[model samples]
Target: MQQDRMEARTAGWGQRQGWGRRADGLARAGRRPRRVAMGAMLLVAGIAWTAQTLGANTTPVCKLSVCWASEADKLRYECDSGCYFESNPVDVEPEAVCNVMAEATHEGSFSYMYRDSVNLVTTGIGNLLASVDDAVALPFMIEENGVSRRATEQEIRDAYNGLSSQSAECIAGNPRRCNTANSYAGENALRLEEDTINQLCQTRLANEFTPGLHRIYPDFDSYPSKVQAALYDMVYNLGEGGLSPPKWPSFNRAMGRKDWQGAADESNRPQLGTTRNDYVRDLLESAADEEEAGRQRLASCASPGFP
Candidate 1:
């Protein structure tokens, strides 16, 4: 009886041990597949993230391939190209994108005209262009700063059109306001924008001055050409109302009538008895200092960045 009991107990222990080993093997096999699956999922996620990043940066230049009904034969399209300025429905459409690109050519080919609104002052072609170049030229880019910027070709044209409209509204087309003496007054003087420059130059500056500033500056008594440029900078800073012109009534009447001292006196007055006398004093003194320096350090600072 004792031998039989011992044999049964031994068999039972062996059976228990075999069952435990089988369970351990099964658990390891299940864990290995789950680890492989988790690794595969992680790899897929990484690849997807990398792909998305690349897609975001790249702008597909569709060379007339994604051509919509409204697109031109040679139009170039990029990401969201037809959405803004060129769509047919005035929404995102095919023609709209083509129009956007077409606008670039027009703006590039178009002339830059700059004018002052305060005195109805308009700049000469040379001066206008140089100023515009000073504002906009930077390798292949032009920064608008507080002003709006058009990144693509379409954007440039859109900005040009919008500003052109503003120019029309600002100018009442007052002939006296457009005069070189008075026309070169507020707009361009105050607003150193492409549109303001264009209005002052194209509308009045081009037509208003006899030969532009050359015509007017020579008439100024005792005022040198360098001084005239300085005065314009002054005008740009201060309005026509702010202008004193060294006894201007006497100066204008004398253009050759007043003589040098008359114009100089009006220009150099310590007080004008109008507006903020203190402010006027500072402006006049600053402009004079810049002129006396006989270099472009101050004048360059006067205008804003890019038209």
Candidate 2:
């Protein structure tokens, strides 16, 4: 069934004919485009193998078409169903990461600017606009007399300043208070489109948090999806520096040794709600279960076949 699905999806690309003709011409010229050929073969085989080995219930991580210009380009980057791959392949499903973050950050309520707990201007799943420049960098929509238009730099700056100057009490769990006519509502109201918010989140994860995660956890890509998500959550919630060895020594030590349960025990944060803490702990525990199952599988494989 998985192979059938894969074949059905690839059928359209195969029918393009242009690719076939190009391949043929290159072959006839004795420059066989081996990398393209090899990449195509690997992509199909890899997807099939991954689906089979991980079981039908498992989500395929790399379902996007391979569009690399060369083998070197392939090595440097690859696109996935929901995220862009960097130099190192992201093992955890990008959708899973996004779901975890969206839930933890905004609970699926994205759009509109608001001040966070610390009275810092924020929007779109905890995206912080620390300065007026930060606010102006992204596109924001402003509504005037029921018509929406793109906000100018001055409007964005004014909104940022207005939100930034609000009292902590007004911002503490009161987004509506922060969005009054004076600040982010009516003529002064500024909002981000959902697509822009999602793009912003993805770009940050790909460029900032994920790379920092790889530096601290060299074997990150080899971990189970749950483990990777848990670690990624930590890196996202707390910046890379906040979760690094110096800041989180115990947790870092547990992670270094692949002690999922130990990491779970050390993963609690006073600032985060209990639900969020429990979510991280549960993910780590689930990873511990996966680790134990893997150990049992290896042990069974090592036993004599005729025993």
Candidate 3:
């Protein structure tokens, strides 16, 4: 009886060991496939991320080639194939800064004309009558409903036709003539005026200053957007031609040298007065400082790699 009990006990032990080994092998087999699937998923995700990064780097870059729309084609379109200026919708970064500065300096008005504090015949935001003789220039485009685009010539012509002799007269204190005497000055006329002013402001900057700046600095995009804004205002106040020659030789020289502070100081000259010169200088420097700080912050940070 003792010998039979020993043999039976040994057989049961062998069967248990065999079952344990099979279970361990099955678990390892299941885990192998799980590990491979996880690695495959990671590889695919890495490839997609790399592709996205390359696409972002490949976005189209633009630079102004033509100065302004020719008399033959007074209107310019956005994001078109040609040079940056001829392309529709100017560069997003600098254009925003320019628009804000201009809007702040010049008030929006429809058929409203007055002698600015500087005693210039000014109409609309940044449309100096002293600089541009006609309120409406040809080949100008207006976006319908203030959002979508409308035909350039027809809209401008309609706005022009709506005007009477009174609206046409944009002289000093007699600005009220359009308010009372004209059939225009309604919502439609105001929309047209706003469109015209916006277009002209952009065109003048493209035509006059952008190309020269781009030529001088390869990394012109890195410059403070406010500098572009200030320059545009200068163009608006003083014609593009006026930026050079007898009036601002020092300022022009400083700009040619890429001397930002020197240009700012030249801009702050007392002759132009604190209102025009100081205001613009502050705008330019502050914008530059802001852009620099943003760049620094980006440089200091580490990339947050794919989760």
TM-score of each candidate structure, all chains considered together:
0.23, 0.64, 0.40
Cα lDDT computed for each candidate against the true fold:
0.30, 0.61, 0.43
The collision pairs in model 3 are: 67-207, 77-87, 77-88, 78-88, 78-89, 79-88
Q: RMSDs, each prediction?
A: 34.1, 12.9, 26.0
lDDT of 2 by residue, 52-138 (tens): 122232222232233456644443222212112222322354444665678744234457777555676677766887877988898
Model 2, residue 110: distance off in Å is 3.2
Model 2's number of clashes is 1
Off by over 4 Å in 1: 1-151, 162-211, 217-230, 234-250, 258-261, 264-307
Looking at model 2, report the run of 10 residues with the lowest lDDT sum: 78-87
Ranking of all predicted structures according to lDDT, beginning with the best and ending with the worst: 2, 3, 1
lDDT for each residue of candidate 1 in 97-179, tens digit (9 for 90 to 100): 22221232111112323343331212322233333333343111234665534345443333333232225433655433332
Counted clashes in each candidate structure:
37, 1, 6
lDDT of 3 at 284: 55
